[model samples]
Every structure is written in C-alpha cells, then in structure tokens.
Target: MKKDNKCVDINVSANVGECAYSRGSTPIADEGDAVIRVPVELAVLNIRTNLAAKIKFPEPVLEIKDIKKRVQIVQCKLLLPGVAAGTDPFVEGSYHLFIKGYVRKNIQYASPCYNSGVCVNSEMRSLTTDVPFECVVEIAEDDFDRTPQLPFQNARAEFDFFRQQDLGHGYPEKDHFLSSDLSQFHQDSSQFYNQMPYCELISSRITEWDEALDRKPFHNSANWQEGTFETISEKMFLQFTVKVLQNQQVRVTAL
Candidate 1:
C-alpha cells in the first residue's frame, strides 16, 4: 500500500501543579461569610529544546553521513478549579496542568569531493514542533466577575535530554522517528489525576445574568495561539566519528 501523505500520528503528555491565591481584592468588615470568585483562561503558549553540546568532528571528517537529530512537543494542557470562599473569608486551593515533549529527526550525507585536500565541513538544519491547548477559567460569585492574571502565564517548560540513548545505532543509517527520552517521557505521563470533571467552557457566555456581563471565559485564548516556546533548557551533544575517504580509497586509518 502507498503511504498516506496527509496522515501523521502524535502523542500527548501532561504536567500538574498546585497553585492558590487569597480570595477577594480586599478584607471584609462583616463577620458573615461571603464568596468571591476570580476567573482566567489557561493555554499552552510554546515548546522549546536546548541542545547540551554541539556534535564535534575532526577537520578532515568531511563526508558526515548518517547524521540525524530530532525534537517535538506532543502534548500541552492546563486544569484549574474555580476558587471559592467560606466563613474564614479566604480562598486556599491548588491546580495542575500537563506539558509533553517529543523529538523527530532525519539523516543527510555530504556531497562527493572532486579536487581538494581534506577539509572540515559543518551543516545545520532547523525544525520546530508546536502544540495548541485551551481551557476555561470559571469563578462564580454573588456579583461582578474578574479575570485574574495567569501565573507563569508565558513561562517555558524545560525538558532534559542528557541521559537519552543514541538513536543512530539501532537500525542501519536511515531516517525514522524515535521517542529518545524515556525517563522524562514517563514522568510527564503520570501527572494527571483528574479528581474534577474538566468543563470545556463554552466559547461564549452561557448565562444572561447581570453578573455575567463580563464573563468572557476564553476571550483571549487566541492571544498566545501562534506563540512557540522552548522545552529543553540545554543542548545535548550529537557527536559523530567518521572517516574521510578519497579516490574511493581509505585515506586515514579508523579510530
């Protein structure tokens, strides 16, 4: 069967954390209990990878074939519960989110040499992985609605790749995708506990109550929709040990 040119499979992962803030903009004078809710929208803005070290080679290793590297972002999402208050007149609670990362790579061979002594050649190719996420920020109350500022709203999640296995050895020098980092892979997979149902907020207001005047749940969800972020903080070394051949003959001995 011929391969489908329009189909691609993607994997997703999650990250969760606990965050809380005090209820209301100011302290109250009445001893009676009251509740104030703050609403906000959450979304995944970007994904990034940091290479630990550059792939090194001797100046004469000109024909660097079977050279490949890969990176990607498989999943990104957020889950936060609505804030509520009781007798003590305070809001104390936490929430969690998910952010998964992945990588894909390809191999390329240097062109044949014609007339020249041994020389050094370096090549660099760039690629990116992007994931979109959306969620509602709901806070119900007696009157008025406020959208709280999202903490770490545009912060980047860092992924480590130093201990990853080499993807170049298993198969013949060729092109394919590999989930190279397993430890971190599982770490991201185990983040979601989902105690509360994720209410996909209606794109528009659902109630016409007077307090609902400013209840645009995800009015700005598209603000960061086109943004991309870095996931790995450092670059990993992608070294290759190659031999320079000349005249279809071995010019230097193998290491």
Candidate 2:
C-alpha cells in the first residue's frame, strides 16, 4: 500500500460547552453561621532502605537490567499540637503536621541471559511489596492564604468590684484589716466550639533509585559471565501537595 506523506485525516472543532456565566454574590449580615474552607501547603518525607533487603524472585535473573518503581499511600494521619475538635475552640498557633503511611512498590526488572558473553534480557520479572514510613512537618500559621474563622467573637465583659463587709468570724486581719466578702463572689465562663481541621491530598510525585547489594554466579556455571542478585537497596524521593482545610462559622462582606 502506498500512502501520501501529507494526507489530511480529520479536523476537530473547539468545544464551547460553557457559555458566558456569572454568579451574583448575595449580601450577608455582619455576622452569621457559615462554613469557610482553608487551604495550605504540605511536604512529603524521603524514604531509604539504608540496608540490603532480600528479594524473592519468581525466577532467578542473570542480571537486573532495569527496575521500575511506584509508590502507594496506605495510611495518612495528620497530628497537630493543641488539636481543635468540632466542639473545641480554635487555638491560634503554629504546629507540626504528622504524617504516617506505607509505600506500595511494584518493582519490575529485566531478566538477563548470556549468549556467548553477550548479556541480553528477554523476560521481565516483577515484585510487589510495601515499605512503611512516617514523618512530622511544620505548618506555620501564615502558610495558607485563607484565615481560619473563629467560633466566637471577643465581647466586652461587664463587672463591678464588690464592697468589703466586716467579718466577725474571720481573724482581725492584723488589727482591723479590710477584706472583700468571698462567699457571695461568683464567676462564669463562656466557650464556643469551632470546626476541626482536616487535610485533602491534591497531588503526589515519586522518584526512585535502586541497586543490587550482592550478586552471585548463575547456577555456578563453569564459564558463565552473568549473575543474579538476591539483595537490593532501594531509595525514593517522594513529594505531595495537600490542602489543609477547616470549615468554620465566618462573617462575609457583601460583594
């Protein structure tokens, strides 16, 4: 079959599924019950095997030509200092964000063969396993653009000093000393609960480098120049972009 080098195939048109659209912001009161969203930056910790790790290959390989790597997060928990609950008042302070998880790795390597001293790998082998990791990252208060809304407003408190009354039952207080009555004094406190903070994973990126720690001759061949590796050392650089969020009652300015 003869095909022209500059033959036209298809022409695609631009998609205009959405036309002009806009939403008018409604005027809100100075204070109201509402939920606001907050976003922040997040960092991922590095992982390294550090020592020789055993590998049980389905079939022994003469040489590891290449290794493919992947990462998976089985668990992710964020720990903070003075953590606020849904019913706990918000505390303003910079704190650490603790993250814990395991990396799920599927390693595929090229199984090599020797043909007259020329090493060639025609078959690829794979292994799937997990490696656990954990870390603590600092999150400053100004890291995120959106400010956390407070559950309660600062209101002026009104109070008055109590008058001192003569207490016959009490000591003379160093010969006629005046003291305020304590039995009738009372105190009260008002606390408001705020929304608990949480996190959402936005994106993840991982890079890996692996090497064979030890290698031995294949089947102890008399003249074989190829060998197989039973131990591998793995290292990875992982990164993640996550959003720290919390829904809280906030006052809105009419737009």
Candidate 3:
C-alpha cells in the first residue's frame, strides 16, 4: 500500500510559571534581627474550550502515529489599574489561571489507485494515551486570606473527556480538476505577460497605483448606469461604493 508524503512535525511548549522565594527581615532593638517567612502563592486560573479541531470529511480517515500534549498558561489581571503593587496579597486574587493542551495525531495518507480510480482509505489512529484537556479555577473573595496554600481545583468533568476518531475516506477528484484548471489559467497568463514588451512597465504602474490607493482609500461602485447602459464591474473600488449605497437603500426602505 502506497502512502502520501509525510511532513515534519513541530512540537512547541508554552511556559507555565517559575518558583521564586522572597525574604523579609525584622529589626529588634534588644535582640538580633529576626527573619520572617514570606511564602509565595501559586497562580490559579480558568479557561473553557472555545474551538475544537474539525473532523475532516464525515469522519477522520488518518492514522495517529503519536500523540503530543502541552499545557498553555493564561494570566488574568485586575480590571482596575494604578493600584500599588505588593498590596494585593493573594496571587489568586490578582490574576486568574487557565490551562489548555493540544494533541496532534500523526498519520499517513493512503495512495490513490489509478486502475479503479479509487483511493485506498485507512483510519488514522491515536497512539498516545494522554488526551487534550482544559482546566479553569476561580478564587473566591473569601478564599484570599490563606496564603502559600494554592487553591488548585480540577474543573474537568468526568464525561468531558474526548478522543479523536477516524472517519471514512473521501475521493477529491473533482477538487483536483478545479485546482488544475486554476493552475493552467495562471500559467498561461504568466507566459503571455512575460512575452509582452511593456509588461514590466504596466505592472510597475499598477503597483504604484495600488500603493496610492492604500494611502487614500476609495470605494468601488457596485452598479452604475451611463444613459441606457448599466455596468457592474467586480473591481474592489466599485464593489465598496455599491455596497455602501445598497446599505443606505436598505436603511431607507426600513425607515
């Protein structure tokens, strides 16, 4: 069985936090200076799943050669600024902490069969045991007094765990045909323009016009009429202008 070419897999990890110690000394007149213990609190945060990986086709057809997991840390700050630093005692009170992990499953694509015009479909399996998960923690206003004791909580529900499944295979022949046509058009246009003597000059002038347009934006007209002839050019300048006019007309109709 033939397999599609494999691309390099990149693994990236995000930093969570570092542990640091703070020292404080108290002065005494009669006795020697006394040292006090100042314990640092671990940051607590919360995050929810906003986006999930799309299952290609009706199902996933790729094989999972390996699974990689990582945790991302998000920090939260107080809405009100200008407050004196170190005054906010609890780390949990100052910022919220959230963690999210990504799982990338590596799989090979089966080669297409030329004789029957059918592609050999195979399922992508996940070899990794750890699944991607998210966790969130919120520090209540009353929970701030006890410092040094980090208030870490498991927010993931038991039923919330998810695993990637292999869907069925798909034949992209139609997609390939459309893509080939687009490529041919681009190639022919390039060859024709390359043979033209004033191609460079025309392209340079177009670039200058594009830069000028960027400096001073203009709207495109969606529809226009010169006497009895109505023309609608799909140019950007015309389209923008036409869209504005259409919006105004819609507002007037509503009113």
Candidate 4:
C-alpha cells in the first residue's frame, strides 16, 4: 500500500556510560601463538531520535490505510585496552574502541486524528519513546572456557576489517575498510576510547501503523472545528557492548 508519509532521514542521540573489560581464554597453544577474545559490556542509559519525513493531506478526512516495520543493524564497536604492545600485565585504566556499520534512517507516525463531524487530516508531527536495551556483560579471557560465545555475529566480518586497519596492518584493500591507525604503540585514545563507557543502539527500527487513535477536541478552543488527536507510535532498540580487544585473533599482520 502507498504510504501517506515516508521517512527520509533520522538523527540518533544517546547516553553511554559504565564500561569494564574482561579477557577470554586462548586455546591450548604456545603463549605467542594462542588467540583470545575479550568481551565488554556498556550500559545504555537513554536513546532518542529526530526524524525527517513528509506528508500531505489530499482531502479533509483521511484514515490510516496501513502500517510498516523496518529494523536493521546500523553499526558495531569493539573495545580494547589502553595497554601498548609488550606491556607487562596490560594497563588497567584507559581503553580503545573500533566501530563499523552502515548509515540508516528512522521514521515514525502517530495515530490518526478527527475533527468536528469530519476527520481532519494532519500536517506533520513529532514523537519520542523510551525503550529498554540488553546490556551484554564483559567476560575475561579465562572465562571463555565455560561460556564460549562471540557477540555481534551478524556484523563480525565487517568488524574484522576495522580491526585489521586499526592494528596498523593491511587487510583486503579491495574491501574498502575505513582508515584508522590503532596499533599498540600508536594508539589514539583521543578519538573513540572511553573508560566509563555506556551502551548505544547500534541498530534501530521504524514502525508505521494505521490503527485508530484515542483523542478528544476542546470545544472552547480558538479552532474547535479542527480537533486534536494522537498519532501512531512505533519504536525498536538493539543494544550491544564495546569490549576491550586485549585478546583478539588477528586476521592480518601489520605491513
């Protein structure tokens, strides 16, 4: 069905905090040859958005015809320790992060409203809703022995590219990974590193509905003929943590 309005753009704002890193166990191998995966979890305080969509009222009375839903993974980030190469027990404080994902858009609409005897169409409206997110925990390297699981399996491949580039090493040039130098010795704590990190929505969803609305008009108002009504509301939130990459399986060596 043709939509009365469509979302053209979306702006995301979020609050992040509470960051901790843990090490995973390396397989049974030599110290230099074994690989370990670190897990980190950041808390997601609050997430909000601003949307850009267009709508037009062709007639005086128009009811919602349909509803739509769109959910997608927007981005991913990997957290790492502040320790440089060849550090004794690995630095305790400070951290680094690697992010990768696609740019996306979000659109929302309210339930249809009515007027005096006739349904008065709406021009445009804005609304915001609070959502709950899952905060993945940070696991230590040795902990991998019991609970062995890697997060963000869907975006792992792309994240791997960002990992390689950050390591000051070269991955597949044809893959077009983002340019970022995060080598052990040349770490840039100025950019995406955080200590008390919070969880952020890496994926978002847009829901559209034509369901009926509950609204009442004010009779003593200036414009009584044009009644006020509530619009439809739809929301989706995906949360993941940025862990310290203290023990990651390197895909490529620095050149």
| Models, CA RMSD each | 33.5, 21.3, 36.3, 21.9
Per-residue lDDT over 139-173 for candidate 3, one digit per residue giving the tens place of the 0 to 100 score: 45554333222222223222222333333357543
List ranges where model 2 is wrong by over 4 Å.
Answer: 1-59, 64-68, 80-90, 110-123, 147-194, 219-225, 251-255
lDDT of 2 by residue, 13-33 (tens): 445466887874322213735
| Best first by TM-score, ranked | 2, 4, 3, 1
Model 4, position 211, has a per-residue lDDT of 30
What lDDT is reached at residue 187 by model 4? 24
Tens digit of per-residue lDDT, candidate 1, span 20-55 = 888644333223344332222222122222333122
RMSD of 4: 21.9
For candidate 2, give the lDDT: 0.53
Error of 1 at 44 (Å): 4.6
Q: Residue 102 error for model 1, in Å?
A: 2.8
* Per-prediction backbone clash count: 23, 0, 17, 17
Tens-place lDDT per residue, model 4, 38-102, is 33332222223333222332222233333333333233343543433223322233222333432
Cα lDDT of candidate 3 equals 0.25
